[model samples]
Each structure stands twice: as structure tokens, then as C-alpha cells.
Target: MPQQVQGVIARSKGAPVELVTVNVPDAGPGEAVVRILACGVCHTDLHYREGGIGDDYPYLLGHEAAGIVEQVGDDVRDLAPGDYVILNWRAVCGTCRACRRGRPWYCFNTFNATQKMTLEDGTELSPALGIGAFMDKTLVAAGQCTKVDERARPAAAGLLGCGVMAGLGAAINTGNVGRGDSVAVIGCGGVGSAAIAGARLAGASKIIAVDVDERKLAVARELGATDAINAREGDPVAQIQALTGGFGADVVIDAVGRPETWLQAFYGRDLAGTVVLVGVPTPEMTLELPLLDVFGRGGSLKSSWYGDCLPDRDFPMLIDLYLQGRLPLDAFVTEEIGIGDIEAAFDKMHAGDVLRSVVILDGPDSDSGSTNPLEAHEGEQVSA
Candidate 1:
């Protein structure tokens, strides 16, 4: 039987998301149904609403989610009912060229659930990022469910599913930030701040943060930025160079994704330094950079897709670090809200008032029911 549940959906371009009834089908082959516990409101969701991602209207938003596996379909072995999991968009297909080369993170062909969740009238709703989760329950490919340490709270752990992972991976994976290296991150938003945290975790000697907003820069400092530069005050490129002892940072990350910020990142790094672009830009936006400069710069310019993260590998380790208090995941949660408060959360995000506004679906008043059947199962392997 199809389960009728409430979900947030952007029915049209530039339209407000409506909490409508979404009929989630039972788990089909290689699919699983997850009972959502918590989900974070991300900028990508807003982009979807604005028609920046695609023309996929009536998109079921909210992807940064943690949940419990309520049911698994045929051929699904690793995940069973009652497993706690973090939902990820990228589910690597092992036979893809990238995966065949032992680089699953770069898998060109990722997986989504074969089945679709529809509305009351049978209108097929496009799931945001292939894992629409702003509901009591969502259907997804079993591979999309990455099991993590249950001790890590749902609000913090779910962040690794999207923006946070992108930022952290931009530094640790794509940028190759190393010990004693100098690093700089542009735009001190959630993703940028996560990059700073990643650089700190990697033992970067000096971490610089550049942002137009002083408030975000302050947050970046708490996330381990050694220096802050207000881009509005002066030329950010020159300031970055000056802060890095007149050379430039070894790695520069542009989290704003605009052409101007891209150029700033290009000129703000030392020669032969890596520049990671982790920000999402619009379709109409074009980047104009001097071809001569591109050739003159001796380092790689890389764009991170979901932080180039392999959920099965990175999720467990990062969660362990968070549980040990080594990773301050809690710092990302600016507020907790109910499902109906997502519109207000979007407003807060637009006003730059919060790093993340998470929807708590496990509260007493939540419409979601407890589906975990393993609570009494002692010694259950919960990690990875």
C-alpha cells in the first residue's frame, strides 16, 4: 500500500513550497523506505524552488536527512530494517568507468530509487537530489542509505549528506590541504566554514576566511580560521596574498561560485596552488577568466561534486570524530524547527541569520511513527 505522508514541495518556479500529501510507494527492488528523523534546510533546496537546478517542477525538497530503515526491497543486503542511516544523493554504480578505476567518488552514474513517489492525484513528484526527504518517510535506492554511528544526533549527522560534506571534501579531498599548509576559503557560509574546519582537521598552519558579511566571518573564526578578510573592505586577492606572507595561500576555495569570486580565488592563491570550486552557480551565469592566466597558473582547478565523498567510507569516520568531540558538528545547527517551519527557515537562511535550520521529525508531536525494530538487538554493528 502507498503511504500517504506530508512533504514539502515547490510546485512551480519562484513559488512557495507547499506541505502536500506525498504518496510514497513501498520499497521496490534495490530500494528502501526510510523513516526520517531529521533534515536540514539547504541552499540547494532553495535553488530548486527558484528553477536554478532544473525545470523539474513540483520538486520534493529536503535531502540532508538522517533516518531509520523501515523496509528493504529484494536484493538489498547491507541495510536492514531498523538500521540508522544518513541519506546521500550519490550512490555509486560499481561498473561505471570512474568506479571501475577505483574512484567511486567520481562515479559518473549514480543511483536513485527506481520507483516514484506521487501526489494524491498521481502526479509524479521529482525528488530533490534524487532523495526527497522532507517527509515522514521517503523511498530511495538502498545504496543511498549510508549507515553511521547512531550516537551522532540526526541533526548534525545528516549535514554530511550535502553542503557540509561538499565543503569539507573540497579541502581534504579535492584541494589536498595538508599539514603546515596555508589555506584560504572565500564566502564563510556553511560550506565554506566546513572547509575551514576540514583544513583545521588537516593541520593547516594558517587558515584564512574571506566574506562580505562580518557575521559569517566571525563564525568562520570559530570554525578555525586563523585570519578573516572582509571582501567589502578591500581587494580580497591582495588581502589574501598579504595574509599569506606576500605569496598566497597554498589552497584557495571559492564557496560563493560567482564569476568574480572565482577570479578572486584564482588570483588569491600562490602559484602552483590548488583552487577548489564547491559553490553552486546558476545556468545563465558565465565565468570570464583570461586564458593566458589559466595557463600561467600551474595548479589544478577542480569542482567538487558532493565534496567528492564516498558516503560509506567518509560517513562513519566523520561521525566517530564528531562523537569524540574532535569535529564540532553541533556548531552547524543554528536552530531546530518543525516541518511546517521550513518556509520561515528559508527566510532565516536568506537573511544570513542561521548556518542551518533543521526540521525535527522525531519529536513527540511528529507525524512519523517509530519504525526501528532493532532497539533490543544488542551488539548490532552500526557503523559503516
Candidate 2:
């Protein structure tokens, strides 16, 4: 039987999302149905609502989610009902050229559930980033469900599905920050702060955080940034160079995807240093840099997509790190609110006042049933 549940839906371009009844089909081959426990409001969701990504209307928004597997299809061998999991957007298709070349993170053929979740009247809805988790439940490709430490709170663990993972991956995976390295992260939002935390985790000796907002800078410090620079106060490139003994950092990450910030990142690093662009940029944005400088700069300039993460490899390791108190995943959750507060959360996000406003679906008034069958099981191992 298809499950009827309440979900946040963007009915049209540039319109506010509404909570509507959606019908989720039972898991089919290579799919799994998850009961979402918590889902975070991310900037991407806002982008989708505004038609920045595409004309895919009636978008089922929200993707950064953590939940439990309620059911699995017949072909889903590794996962079963009752598994605690994080929903990942990229489910790598191993037969793609990128995957065949052993770079699954760059897999061109990622997948979502074959079946569609629809509006009550049978209008097919497009799930945001293929997860569409701002609901009581969501269906995804079985490979998109990455099991992690069950002890971690849903509010915290689910964040690894998106921005947090992107930030961490920017430092550890894309930037490749190393022990005794000097690293700089620009744009101290959830992604930038996570990059700082990742740098700390990777043993970066000097971690500089640059942001326009003082509040976000403070949060960056708490996330393990050794130094903070307000971009509004001075030239971030000059400040970063001055702090790094006149050479500049080994790796500079731009977490804000703007032409100006991209230019800042270009000039902010040392010769042969890596520049990691983790921020999403619009189509109209164009970067202009001197051809001489492009030739003179002797390092790799790369863009990080979803932090170049492989769900099977990165998610569980990060969760274990979180459980051991090394990674402050909990710090990402600024506040937890009910589903009705999503609009308010978006306002807060737009105002740059919060790291993450998570929708807690376990609340008393939630439309979801109180007792989750998945939560009843004490111990079950799902192979990664």
C-alpha cells in the first residue's frame, strides 16, 4: 500500500513551500523507504523553490535527513527494515565512466528511487536532490541510504547528508589539508565552519576563517578555526597572506560561490597551493582573472561537488568520529522546530542568523506514527 504522509512541497517556481499530503509507494527493486526523523533546511532547498536549479515544479524539498529504514525491496541485500541511516543524494552507479575509472565520487550516473512520490491527486512531484526528505517519510535508491552510528542524534547525524559533509570533504578530501599545513576557509556558513572543523581534524596547524558576518565568525572559531577575519573589515587575501608569514595558506577554500569570493580565493593562497571551490555559483556569474596570474599560479584550482564524498566510505567514518567527541556534529544544529516552522526556518537562514534549523519529525504533534518499528530493534548490522 502507498503511504499517505505530510510533506513540504514547492508547488511552483518562486513560491513559498506548503505542507501537503504526498503518496509514497512501497519500495521497489533497488529501493528503500525511510521514516525521516529529522531534516535540515539548506540553501539548496531555497534555490529549488526559486527555480534556480530547474523548472522541476512541485519539488519535494529538503534533502539533508537522517532516518530509519522502514522497508527494503527484494533486491536490497545490504539494508533491511530498522536500519539507522543518512540519506545521500548521490547514489553512484558503478557502471558509469567515472565509476569505471575508479572515481565514483564523480559518477555521472547517480540514481534515485525508480518510483515517484506524488501529490494526493496523483500529480508526480520532483524530489529535491532526489531525497525530498522534508516529510514523514521518503523513498530513495537503496545505495543512497548510508548507515551510521545509531547512538548519534538524528538532528546531528542527518546533517552529514549535506552541508556538513560538503565542508568536511572540502578540507579532508578536496583541499587535502595535512598536518602542519596552513588552511584558510572563506564564507563561514555551515559549509565553511565544517571545512574549518575538517582542517582541525586533519591536523592543520593554522586554520584561518574569513567571513563577512561576525556571528558566523564566532561560530567558526567554536568549530576549531585558529583565527577569524571579517572580510568586511579588510582585504581577506591580504589578511590571509599576512597571517601566513607573507606566503599565504597551503589550501584556501571558497565556501561562498560568488565571482568576487572566487577571485579572493584565487589570490588568497600560496604559490602551488590548492584552491577548493565548494560553494555553488549561479549561471550568470563569470570569473575574470588575469591570464598572466592564471599562468603564474602553479597549483590546482578545483571545484568540489558534494565535497567529493563517497557515501559508503565517508558517512560511517564521520559518524564514528562524531560519537568519539572529535567531530562536533551537534554544534551544527542551531535550533530544532516542527514541520510547520519550515518557513520561519527559511527566514532565519536567509537572514544568516542560524547554522541549521532542523525539522524534528519525532514531535508529539507530528503526523508520523509515534512508534517506529525500525527503532524497536536493538542491534542490526547493515553492510556498507
Candidate 3:
């Protein structure tokens, strides 16, 4: 039987998000149904609400989430009911060319549930990043569920589903940050901060944080940055160079994803040093550096997609590190909120007031009488 659950959705482009009756169908074939425990409100979710991601209307919001496998289809084997798991967007298809090459992280054919979740009126909904989780329960492909230690809190562990994983992987997997390396991260938001933490976890001797906001720089220091640069105060490139003995850092990551920040990262590193761009950018944004400069850099310039993470390989290891107190996953979660507070969470996120505002779903039928959560932004175009 299809389960009737209360889930959040953006009914149209730039319209307020609506909490409506979502019909979650039972798992079929290689799919499983998960009972959501907690989910973080991400900037990407705000993007969906504002129609920044796509024209896929009625997008089921929320993706960074932790849950339990409540049920699985007959063919499923690796997952069973009661397994604690984090939902990931990259459900790698084993037969894809990327997977066949033993680099499934670049799997060209990631996937979601074959069957659709729908509105109570029978309208089909597009799941955000193929893992719509701002609800009591969500259905996903079996491969999308990665089991981890249950000792980790849902609010913190769920974050590894997206931004946190992106940042950490940017350093460890893409940038190839190594022990005793000098590293710098630009942005200091959720993703950038996580990259700082990743640098620390990778045993970096020095981690430099760059951001326009002072408060975020403080948070970045707590996350393990040895130095913080206020990008607005002076030339960040020069500052980074001065701090790294005039040679710049060994690895510099651009978490802001803008051309300006990218250029700053490009010049704020040692010759042949790696620059990893983890920050997302608008489609219209473009970069045009001198072709000579690109050739003269003499190092790798990389774009980190989902931090180039392999969920099955990285998620459990990160959760273990979190449990052992070696990683500061909990610090990334600034607050725990009710599902109804999503719009306010978005505002807080945009205002740089919080690192993360996660929704803690205690029960399957949880409700706070919120039908429309966008009262604060009514009729106003969300500035990109």
C-alpha cells in the first residue's frame, strides 16, 4: 500500500513551499523505503524553492538526510529493516563506464527510485537530487542507502549526505590534501568550513581560511584553520602568500565558486599547487584568465563534483571518525529545528547567522500546523 506522508514541496517556480500530502509508494525492484530521522536544510534546497536548479516543478525538497531502512523490495539483500543509513544522490550503477573503471565516484549513471512518489492528487513530484527527504519517509534505490554506525546523531551524520561530504572529499579525494601539507580554503560556509575540517583531518600542518564574514572565520579557526584572512580587508591572494612564506599554500580550495574567488585561489597557491573548486556557481558565471596564466600555473585545476565522493567508501569512515572525536561533524550543525521552520532556516542560512539548521523529525506523523512555510518571502523575488 502507498503510504500517505506529510512532505514539503515547491509547487511551482519561485512559489512558497507547501507541506502537502505526499503518497510514498512501497519499495519496488531494487528500491527501499526509509523512515527519515533527521534532515539538514541546505542552500540547494533553498535553490529548489527559488527555481535555481531546474524547471522541475513541485520539487520534493531536502536531500541531506539520515534515516532507517524501514522496508526493502524482495530483491534487495545488502539492506534490511532497521539499518541506519545516510541517503546519497550518487547511487552508482555498477555497469557504467566509470564504475567499470573502478572509479565509481565518477559513475556517469547515478540513479534514484524507478517508481515515483506523488502528490495526493496523483501529480508526480521530482525529488531533489533524486533523494527528496524532507518528510516522514522517502523511497530510494537500494544503492543510494549507505549504512553507518548508529551511534552518530542523525542531525550530524545526515550532513555527510551532501555538503559536508562535498567539502571533505574536495580535499581528501580531489585536491589530494596530504599530511603536513599547507592548505587554504575560501568561503568558510558549510562546504568551505567542512573543507577546513577535512584539511585538519588529513593531518595538514597549516590550514588557512578565507572569507568575507568575520564570524565565519572564527568558526573556521575552530574547525582547524591556523590562520584566517578577511577577503574584504585586503588582497586575499597577497595575504595568503604572506602567511605561507611568500610561496602561498600547497593546496588552495575555492568554495565560493565565483570567478573572482577562483582567481584568488588560482594565484594564492605555490607554483604547481592544486586548486580545487568545490563551490557551486550560477550557470551564467564564466571565467577568462590569460591562456598563458593557465599554461604557466603548472599544476592541476579541478572541479569537485559532490566532492568526488564514493559514498560506500567514505560515509562509514567519516561517521567512524565523527564517533571517535577526530572529526567535528557536530560543529557544522548550528541548530536543530522543526520541519515547519524551513523558510526561517533558509533566511538564517543566507544571512550567515548559522552553519546549518536541521529538521529533527521525531515521529512519522509530526506536524506543527505549517502548510505554507514561505510567509516571510511572499511576493519577493529571491535574489540569486
Write down the RMSD of all candidates, one decimal each: 8.0, 7.6, 4.7
**CA lDDT for candidate 1:** 0.88
lDDT of 3 by residue, 1-384 (tens): 889998999988877788888999999999999999999999999889888998888899999999999999999999999999999999999999999999999999998999999997799999999999999999999999999999998989999999999999999999999989999999988899899999999999999999877777777888899999987789999999999999989999999889999999999989999999998899999989899988897899999999999999999999999999999888887777887888888877877777777898865424323322222222321111
Note the residue pairs that clash in candidate 1: none
Candidate 1 residues 224-274, lDDT tens each? Answer: 999999887899999999998899999999898888898999999999998
Candidate lDDT values, in order = 0.88, 0.89, 0.89
Report the Cα lDDT for candidate 3: 0.89
Model 2 C-alpha lDDT per residue in residues 307-352, reported as the tens digit of each score: 9999999999999999999999888888778988988988777767
Q: Give candidate 2's error at residue 175 in angstroms.
A: 0.4
Instruction: Name the runs in model 3 displaced over 4 angstroms.
Output: 364-384
TM-scores for the candidates: 0.94, 0.94, 0.94
Clash statistics: count for each candidate:
0, 0, 0
Model 2 segments more than 4 A misplaced: 365-384
